[model samples]
Target: MNHRPAEARQSPARTTEVGVRYAIVPVPVLSLETVARRTGLHPDLIRRFVALGLVDAGRDTSGRPVFAPTAPAALARVQRLRTGLCLNYASIGLVLDLLDRISLLEAALRRAGMRSDLPPWT
Candidate 1:
């Protein structure tokens, strides 16, 4: 008797091509306090990141900043990059931007049936 919860039993990215129904749980919208608690970063730091354009935030009806569910992971990545590489916030922001661009380009290339390989850094 498999007694897994409905959510636990279903894969988030299941596709009909594999005879499974596709299901994507909606991304959460979080408040600043919730974001701080979830990410273990101070609200001030999160604000700073926003000011630095490191993380993007949307506004609530009250004109307060709100974050997406993915913000915590993005914050963690910023912290890791800062501590691991000793990079300043500006540099970190640039790196993240480049990484996002690379991802978009790779996806575009894949759709166009072109190989998108990284150039060797020598």
Candidate 2:
């Protein structure tokens, strides 16, 4: 019982004047206080994450740090590593070092014309 129409079997896309745009990325913009509220961390510690260049936060017109939606997940990971593993800030440095290696691997792959659908942390 194959009753699907030909158009229905076609690739799903919004028919706009600019053709097809397949990527649907979620960009959540959050303030520092909002990130602290979401991650249950102190504002100062969130600032430290920004200072360490761990989270991808950017500025609004007012020039305040606005975190992405992924920031909460990243902060949760860092918090878990710090609390559960009893990792000091210095050990956090080591964790970031390993992550940087992974980043280098991904960059090399990209430079070699390979692709990765996963994030660096994943």
Candidate 3:
């Protein structure tokens, strides 16, 4: 008699139209405390960053803020901008916005086959 469950009987590999097989993997979510530990920042400071929109977070079932694995890196970037450029939190928001816009423009330029290094008049 077969005792294995139905899921165990099937192959784990998933195939796409191109015949490439892929395995599904779940992304790890971090809690606020974990993010704080990873970034070496106080939990209050991390909460302030979340309040200031410097980092993105989602609410868990208990109403606590949860973060993606990238939260630590984002917090580090904010810290770099703060200490390296001497920018305040409010100014950091503006700087981050401008940087994102620049990135998008650069990506568009690349997609259009234009060299970003060259001057526009060239």
Q: Each candidate's lDDT (Cα)?
A: 0.77, 0.69, 0.79
Residue lDDT tens for model 3, 42-119: 999998888887777777779998887767887898999999999999888778777877998999999999999999
Arrange candidates by TM-score, descending. Answer: 3, 1, 2
**Best of the candidates, TM-score:** 3
Clashes in each model (backbone N, CA, C under 3 Å)? 0, 0, 0
Query: What TM-score, over all chains together, does every model reach?
Result: 0.70, 0.56, 0.77
Off by over 4 Å in 1: 1-28, 118-122
Question: What is candidate 1's TM-score against the reference?
Answer: 0.70
CA error at residue 117 for candidate 3, angstroms: 0.7
lDDT of candidate 1 over 1-122, digit per residue (tens): 11111233333665677687555765457899999999899999999988787877867679999877777888898899899999998889878877877887899988987777755352
